[model samples]
Target chain A: MAIAKICGTETEYGLRMLPPGDHNPVSISSLLVSSYVDEVQRQIDWDFEDESPGNDARGFSLESAMAPAVEAHLLNAVLANGSRYYVDHAHPELSTPECTDALELVRYDKAGEAILRRSMDAARRVLHEGASIVVYKNNSDGKGNSYGCHENYLMARSVPFAQIVHHVVPHFVSRQIFTGAGKIGSEARWWDRAEQAPHFQISQRADFFEEIVGLETTLKRPIVNTRDEPHADPQRYRRLHVIVGDANLSEVSTYLKVASTAIVLAMIEDGFFGEMDLTVENPVQAMHDVSADLELAKSFRLVSGRTVTALGIQWELLQLAKKYAAERGLDCVGGEERGSDALARWERTLELLEQDPSSLSRQLDWVAKLELLEAYRDRTGASWQDRRLAMLDLQYHDLRPERSLFARLDMERLTSDEDVDRAVREPPRGTRAWFRGTCLSRWPTQIVSANWDSLVFDVGSDPLRRVPMMDPLKGTADQVGALVAQAATPAELLRLLSE
Target chain B: MMPERELKKRSSASRQDEGDVAASAGAPPEAATAARQGERIKADLDDLLDEIDEVLEDNAEEFIRGYVQKGGE
Candidate 1:
């Protein structure tokens, strides 16, 4: 056994205010937090100190220069469980400390529910006072936009980055069925039919993202961040930095989403899952394909050079999930009945793909192409020089809500620097985080300001470990070489070198 | 027994005499005065009864409305 340990935390909530009327809803959240803080503190104190086998309560609080009146009024108190629930930016985020076991981690995560329930009760208490809080677990609103629900994982630097990517990428793309916090609008729209539900689905597209692989603290981040920040034993551990998921509401979904990836990575390391044939007709096209329709399946080559459908791999994983659930006496994986539905869908998809792979490929291609064309029209203008060429733009860069200089100009007119400057100042809400500084030159808010509080964990560990996964599509040969070079051992490097 | 009969006859005779005196006084007939007194008493009683009935009706309506609205029914 690799002695697996898993812990991560994030908050995904929507911003809402009372409509201008006699009722004021924004203040309600604050009032609610204040009223329930004492009760919540009492509950946490009982759970943490009173229930502990030993009365050892130290090394949790840190002194700060915050005004005492403000702190007391805000209920800025630390709990005995080594978890602090204090206001973060503007959101209430409950961050769990790295736990020794998965069960412990889940228990700590559940504490967030208790905290939220208390807060809601407090809100109801002062409902007459007038303030309402809106919670959103989505990354972006319906109209091709984005927000943040970050992920943090602890891993060992001893594990080769290449191996991690191979184990993690497929699961990352496929995990959306369980982990996706449903969406209301289409992700991609057709150019001619701009009004159609633009790629609207109820889940995060596992594929439509940028790949910037490095630890450099710049304005732009790699889609899969590998920056190592050791919070524990640095010599032995690495923390994987993930920043491309919509916050999920369902606890089971969140657990399955992260835990399944961790399990797959472990299996890959233990040689349980064989090497996958990772070749794609177009790596960018495939990513766009995956992003456009999560249900779309692709054929991946196995190490044996035999082509296997993505749906086939999912079926195999579903069987493993069934076995895991049975052994653990779990009613279902992630406490969800729908996990079985997902398994069934994969089985059905595999059978269909087995009958005819080409038809599936063509269908996926059509979807991918249509999404690309619509994304381009939305980004550029309606009168694109070559509608077919839009695929290049969609793959070359992520489609943000911002417009380029050429995009604003009439197809016939030339543009000036002033025109570009004005457009850049106030880019659309969905501009890519990477391009905000470079193109828009606007410093976007890095620290999210939420009304909810967060818990801080000092695990007393060394630097966090990070392993970068390769973009199955769009990653350059040099980038792949760099990742291969970072492998800890010769054997791992040799595998990639041979390839 | 003879004394009791005499007292009753005297009381009846006095009532008749009082009625004759009020009728002869010409303000109003004694029977009309009695009917007015009876009507006044009846109006007062009806007002009290109506007040009680309104209170009960209002309370019952409120209780039923509250029960159904709260999903109690």
Candidate 2:
């Protein structure tokens, strides 16, 4: 069912050149990404032969919706951890290796933060005097522009795309109550003259969305991205690349964001949600409105003309998820036990938000940020528009523990430091990442390039041998671990694979 | 809204970055207002440039070239 809910996260970290100046983000991003690849792991090229970002799921791409180019000359590398650390659109983007479960995704996501931290140090050694890369696990530049932290979930090809769009839009619109990373002031150009001018928003990425559905990511960003490029067996799976989430610093927030969404997707595929019409009239506007409403009392017009607050909608979804678990089971998200844990956590979080949003200061990003900002505002006697408050908001996302405002706060953590550290060097054993990471680690010199579904090896042959891994469920540690252990060289591995 | 007493009581215990608070606190009201005004202007310019970037990104061939030219590739 849904191929083990195979999921991954891609975060384009917000970066600034310290001793801030008019530095080219593209060059600095390239340097930062390359420093990690050059210093930390074996560098392998990303094969773009199968990439077709222009292919829209709706059978026709918008004429204006240009697909992201596969730039072969860029500083792209497949790490020994099976993750891709590369620069995309002048941002240092770290895409976690395919994960079999949500919790594993958290560990890998935390590992990505560590890798970025290490990248900063490595880049420091090479950067110009008095210049350094300060990375933030944030979505916005605080200048009306926002980056992305996209999540990928592998779903069965049998499920209709229209159903996915209909079910997910409400969750995407309402989930910000917990998933939000918090933002200072509204940057939405359209919301500039709204009746309720928000002093702060629940989510950093919510204000930047311009469409409910589309293929473009940088411009006219959609809540449910329509890019249908599945890096696996196309007939068997479709990777739902979600670009609507924030780059969360709170571990609990990250965990819940992935887990809850996975559970909802599972529920959708299992037909547990019977005629659930949670559609908002304008999803783009609703996302901003939900985030801006501090009281969590503002309601959006549903398709039925019924109004529901973000919290109310989430509560309904949670109840359905609970019933879904009771009936079919939650094996899609690790196991029934893990699924129950996600549900319990979701219920508790919603309860807290309902009772008092501030009660979740330690459990959620938006609450913690709100508490910190309010505290700062009271102490300094500053207004919400104060530049210091804005700076404080940005500092909350800083990656450095010594300087990070979020790190100082008593936020609840789900993953251990050891797990995060280990995840930086190793891949999750249950996915194809194990095969990809093992090859890169064992024979760094032999492997020429790698991607999600395959690897190309030189193996001393006149023609490079391309090993096809069309299935995400195959080539896992169980399937290839013994074979990998037995092979001594790339040539031997190639020969073994041929067999 | 937090009670004034509650805000004062908790803020001192919760506030760790004294230097940051002081930095923002040190700015004079007039200077801060002027700076905020400047930021608004700059934000307006940034919005315009981003719109231009969006237009460039809409075209397939031009977007690819721009991607490389902007050091994206």
Candidate 3:
């Protein structure tokens, strides 16, 4: 059987202070995060001692790929909602709490957006007159630089890194058919040819990735990232940090992005993909080409000399996942039911794409964005390179609910408004997040620092007691809710834990 | 301490599926049985809430009030 697919997302929102001139993003992002933390009154610090971003899974460490420094000066706060709301690399980042299933993850991701929206409001009060900060849930800045909306999945440590790379590379290259968040035009050097003009691409992050496999995220990003930080029992599991995905506004796209990837990971762990190597020759180039090809007909040669389109590859993966589920059951992708939902949606999306890509204009992010832009261009007689169109593209991702084009779209929502509202305040009950969130909610001031796998409590003692949550599946509501309710203060909780 | 609120509305979305997995691919019989066992394990291992609002009522009033308050005229 496959391991439980525990997962979460870390979204680094693009930020710019209004009257966008020579301004520092670091200061603006810090202001945004600080204002939110101040407004919520949950200003607990983040523990960064367990992070090991430089330890690559490819056996040898890249000495140049130094881990991110823990800047204690930055406004890094752990929310009572079991999330980390902070400034990461000069961008306002919201790392959702660990979730047991994809649907729960979607609710938390939406809550992150709500947090950003509130942060925008809080930041406005502190800003200078006629100057407000704006945040976008998109990947690129329309310049050469790109931010990330990274995904993390827990995989078993027994699986070889090489097999993970080989199996996942093809899916990463081709899954953009539905997972893409859509971009205005290409910025990669390879697309600078005279014959191939810069036009709308399917994915916003594809053009920026330069390497097939690497450790550096800001510079040369890899398709299958080799970062081996599990944040759990290291001997039992490995956390797959995927940096290649775009921040999707459409809920259906977000669901598919996490669910389908989880199913594939399960198949990989179960040894179900027997000799089915759909490895592309040059994944970096193919990733760009597949994104640029809107028609979904552009074919890339696989390692077996067989040419396959992105849609074709998705269809193959879907069929395999279906068979895997039929035999193994959809248990690893949450349960039989949720796994079935993923397959049904995956099949329907592929079926619609096969008929006409426009058929999915309401469900898929790229198609809807393309339709919106093209309709505007036709109505106003504007060229593809019109600056107004680019502005429209940027407005699609604006964090302000009323101004955001994505918010206005008739996209299928997997989560309810009430649930999303609750997720903004409460944590999921099935993981260690329950303990972390309940603690923060019960005794906010007593907690000094918290991270993915540990929490430090100040009990009016000289040395704070650190509770280790090394098991992602442990410390759930069933295990810790009674204990948390029974203990009142940090001292009592520590005593109870010791008992 | 506040009483645990009963969820009047279904907080967790109904994970209803349209169709079953099409077992067209040629997998051995053992694989199918292994998958069934996996399904049993999945159910036993994780205890998720059918009603998310039960545990989620702690800060609802504060959150909604804050949201409306922040939407200043």
Give the fraction of true interface contacts kept by model 3. Answer: 0.00
Clashes of 2: 1
Instruction: Going through the candidates in order, state the TM-score of chain A alone for each one.
Output: 0.50, 0.97, 0.97
| Candidate 3: RMSD to truth | 12.1
A1-499, model 3: which lDDT tens digit per residue?
9888999999988876765566777788899999888888779888888887778897776776554574566789888889998877678889999998888899999999999999999989888888888888988766567889999998999999888888888899999989999987776777557359447989988987888887778877778788888899999999999988999998888899999899888889889999788989888889988898998889999989999999999889998999999899876678988889889999998988887887677688899788777766765687877765676677678787545667645467898999999999998998899999989998898899999999999989778899999999888999978988999798998888889
Q: TM-score of predicted model 3?
A: 0.86
Name the lDDT value of residue A248 in candidate 2: 86
Question: Model 1, A115-206: lDDT tens per residue?
Answer: 55456556556555664443323354333444455565656557766665555555554444444544323544333464543333424433
lDDT of 2 by residue, A160-278 (tens): 99899999999999999889989888767875475556888898888778899988788778899999989998888899999999888888888889999998898777767788788
Q: Candidate 2's error at A444, in angstroms?
A: 0.4
The DockQ-based CAPRI class assigned to model 3 is incorrect
**Residue runs of model 1 more than 4 Å from their true location after superposition:** A20-39, A42-90, A97-110, A123-128, A143-145, A187-199, A205-208, A212-223, A271-288, A294-310, A316-499, B1-73
Which residue window of length 10 is worst by lDDT in model 2 chain A?
A: A61-70
Which stretches in model 3 have alpha-carbon errors above 4 Å?
A67-70, A192-195, B1-73
The candidate that achieves the highest DockQ relative to the unseen native structure: 2
